[model samples]
Target chain A: MTPEPSPSAPTAAPPVPSTRPAATLQRRLFLVGSLLVAGLALSVVAFGDLGEDLVYFWDPSQMAAAGEDAVGATIRLGGVVKAGTVQWQPDANSLKFIVTDGKVEVPVEATGAPPQMFREGIGVVVEGTLTKSGVFTSDRLMVKHSNEYKAPEGEMSAEERKTLYTTVEEL
Target chain B: MNEVAEPVATGVITGGWSYIWAAYGVTWAALLLFLGRALLLSRAPDPEPE
Candidate 1:
């Protein structure tokens, strides 16, 4: 039988229940731990493609802020070929053009066979670095295409930029 | 985060079967771990009697 309430217990205290479950707490902690571990694992694997150099694309505005540190920094610049400003040294495999973002212009020099779609008046993204000559040496080039779905036109050059830069649409 | 208008690459997994398989492997492992954690939580032991 339950012991009778003591006189000092006249102010009877109600029975109290435990607020937390030990196992539940442990498991919750384990789940959170697992989540954190999983996140860490994914980060390591994700960084596998990013080399130690940690290069990134930058606009002409950002180039100055990066300072001398910008040298040797691999970057990709996206812009259009300024009209009437393309100069290709055909014998040397180098094509120099003014790349603009409608804000500032950056000179780019690419030495190699350009992508099939490479042309003037079209959007392009260049991957490379800025040189001592203040020109970007591209490693890769891409030509942007319209989603309208149509066949591509051919190359652009000194003659084309001067004449064809005006007629945006195909004949 | 470069120009939002232009996509860097198409979303389609065109590299090859190897790249596709690797992505699926990571996805499945994460899903299984999440399910396992949920089951453990649902089966948490009840509080013992005082």
Candidate 2:
């Protein structure tokens, strides 16, 4: 049956006002991004804990370039432990020595049994901060070993520690 | 725990596990912060509309 051609059907969309404004979604995105970046920058500076870039590591040569900035920062300086420079408090538990790159010397003091790999002319990493005397007062000492074998410090250092601490307790 | 506190202790914090943990934390946080800064400064283009 050839029914009469129906008129065009109406769409179900809500009517749009002729004068209504269109939203700029890009503006919202830009604002969100800008605010987030600013927030992160502020936090990074305030908490600087996350910014370990301020942590300094230098040999004597590099340290000359990294002057006042390294005053209070924890640093790691590696070199050979100087011979005839190691001093102890009459007890072997605490030892102080100089680390040299064969050019300049860095003072390192460690207060415990030396690591197995610790020996004169061997590489060591001393972790600590610089003091007013321009000395590296270290609380920790780690030594480098070869062939995957560690030569742990025997009873010599341990005996020294026991004696030192006993004396401290007695005093 | 201390040897003096407990009066007779042998080993408490012997190994360097704590230092290892501290290093791990600092490293991860620093890396994440670096990545965050890099992403914040990155400029990229939007995809084409379907």
Note the residue pairs that clash in candidate 1: none
lDDT of 2 at A89: 52
TM-score of 2: 0.40
How would you encode candidate 2's per-residue C-alpha lDDT over A46-129 as one tens digit per residue? Answer: 986854566434666565456677567788877777765655553546677888888878777777766644656777778888
Model 2, A86: alpha-carbon shift in Å? 1.3
Candidate 1 chain B lDDT trough over 10 residues, lowest sum = B3-12
Candidate 2 chain A lDDT trough over 10 residues, lowest sum = A4-13
lDDT of each: 0.69, 0.67
Q: Write the per-residue lDDT of candidate 2 for residues B1-50, one digit (tens) a residue.
A: 22112111121226788899999999999999999988877855433333
Per-prediction TM-score, please?
A: 0.42, 0.40
DockQ of structure 2: 0.04
